[model samples]
Target: MTHAERAADFLLDEARTDWHDESLWQVRGKRDTIVHAIPEWEALRQLGSDIKDNVLSNLDTYLEQFERQATANGVTVHWAKDAAEHNRIVHSILARHRVNRIVKSKSMLTEECHLNQYLKQQGIEVIDTDLGERIIQLRKEPPSHIVMPAIHLKKEEIGQLFYEQLGTDEGASDPQYLTEAARQHLREKFLAAKAAITGVNFAVAETGGIVVCTNEGNADMGVHLAPVQIHCMGIEKVIPQAEHLGVFTRLLGRSATGQPITIYTSHHHRPKEGGEMHVVIVDNGRTEQLGREEFRNSLKCIRCGACMNTCPIYRRSGGHSYDHTIPGPIGSILSPGIDLKKHGDLAFASTLCGSCSDVCPVKIDIHDQLYKWRQMVSEEGLLPKTKTIPLAGAGTVLSHNGLYNIMGKAARVALSHAPRVLVYNGMNPWGKTRELPEVPKESFKEWYARTHKSKF
Candidate 1:
């Protein structure tokens, strides 16, 4: 099924859908409260955008500088041109250490690379240490949100998941109780793990360090406790200088979850004493995205997820509906660049409300890009004939004033007089979910002309 079909299925459970909508709306509300209080929020966003623009313009220079500094600080750096290379590099590191099990913190880059499945196929066990990540890991599901991995799930669902996996009390659903149980469970994994993998929120070129922001301190625990630490970052994660960190760090948490700042913003400049640290920089179609003039601005994303929260379509449709690693407005634009044929349907998943762009901490024109992708998809002939045929006909008619006026009158007459079965039939895809509007008897032009005849 296409993304729209999957999203339609998600809407079947009204109560669950309502719960999901309210949950994200609440996050958006919190972000508004905090962002409005900050008089410099817009300025920060503009600065963050400008910094990223500069970084992208000279990405090669910044990356080389970052690698030089990181290597000097006793960190090993690996570059991957694509996902396969990224997965191979990570596995090679694991094999070099002869480690079978590893603890991992929240890293969406890993998800994009399908690192967990690849490692598991090679006989490695990867344990997600974040609370939300662990919950979804047990459920064998991808995260619905970047920051809150299992936000789609409720306490009762979590209680059942923990009961089945961690042997927690069968009826316990309290947040504190579940968190403690998970903490104890993950602690054992952390201590026993010989290596750990984490995602980099920001990689500062000037200091040759990486920043990981987490609420649970999972990244720090996993990195510090393990003998080997692997940090995965997309090439776009690099910024020019250390001072730029101040702007992004301030915007990240407040925009994502409305917190003043992340509870723990750990900067790892070097590996632990006697431990090895590896940073894998993966392009995986990022350079291709960067080369696209219209879409390159999407690279500025800090992954704060504020756009996802404010997106009405995203809240109701659910993240999984996008059928991509990262789902929502941002994902809609980025995923198509990775595989136009496979993810072409994602571009049509938005209402073009522009709310996503309005709330972006880095001012990515998400909705505008989504619209642009639609044109690109259609131009590439990726859209199904069902849409293309009708759109082509509409385009032809709309280009001719006489045909346009004739079609408008005919449409109003048919909509107003057609029988229920005829107007709301199987052929009308839109009529399945929503009723056709009550068409007025007269066209707007006809009514206007009649009303203003004396004046004219």
Candidate 2:
């Protein structure tokens, strides 16, 4: 189904949609409050963007440096060109260790690669140790948000899920109680896990280490406890220097959850005394995006999810409406780059209010990229004829001044006097959910000419 169709289905339950909208808006409000409190928030954002720009510009140099330094630090680095290769490398790592059970912590990279499903197919059991991830894992669904995987669900639903999956109290819906249940449940997985996989928030080329920020400390627990620790990072996660971390670390939490910092911001430079560490640097369409000058800036994303929280379309439509791993403004722009034919509808999902770009810590022009994606989709013949035909006709009329003036007058006259049935017909998609505006007696040009002609 198209993104619009899926979004329309989501809007069927008005109360649920309002709840989703308000929940994200509340997060956005918290972010605004925290960001405003910081005297140098904008400066920090600029610094972060500059750091990423430098990284992308010299990505190959930084990546090789990171690998060399990481290898010197006794960490193994693997490179994957695409999703299938990423999954294979991860599976091979697990297979090499004869690992049957592994625990993972809040890795969106794994979601992108569908690593869990791939390992499961190979008879390996993967447990998501993060609370939100565990909830959705039990429910057999993809995350609805980047930071909060299960944000689409309610406390009661979670209570029930815990009741069924974790055998908690049948009707307990308290956050604290449910959290305790999850902590106890995941603790077992941590203790028994043979290997642990994590997503990288930032990888420092100078330090040859990766940083993971999590409120629950699940990533720390899983990695530190496991005998084998695997860190999966997109190539774009690299930064040129260690000092650049200060800028990104400052912006990440405030932008993501309005906190000064996550509860635990763990850095891994090397493996434990007896443990083995592996880092998979996956390209997975990132290099393709990098080659596109118009959209390369999107690679600057730190996965803070600020854009998702501030996007009105995401809030009202819900993340599942996009039908991709990363949804909302960022996802809309990135998904088309990955597969324009399949995800072209995502580019048209927004109202282009530019709230996402305003909130982006890395300063990615998300709305502008969305507009550019739409044009690219059209040029690639991914757009449906229904839209292309009308747009082409409109373009022709708009290009001719006489036709434009005649159509403007005719439109105003028809809108002013036409019957409701004629104006609100099935052929007019906009009329389905919106009322036609009342036409003024004169067009703006006509009124301007009448009022200012003598002065001219």
The lDDT of each candidate is 0.93, 0.93
Clashing pairs in 2: none
Candidate 2: tens digits of C-alpha lDDT, residues 135-220:
99999999999999999899999999999988999999999999999999888889999999999998999989999999998999
lDDT of model number 2? 0.93
**Total clashing pairs for each candidate:** 0, 0
The segments of candidate 1 whose C-alpha lies over 4 angstroms from its true place after superposition are 420-438
Q: Please provide, for model 1 over 78-165, each residue's C-alpha lDDT reduced to its tens digit, 9 standing for 90 to 100.
A: 9999999999999999999999999999999999999999999999999999999999999999998888879899999999999999
lDDT of 1 at 349: 88
Instruction: Please give the RMSD to the true structure for each candidate, in Å.
Output: 1.7, 1.6
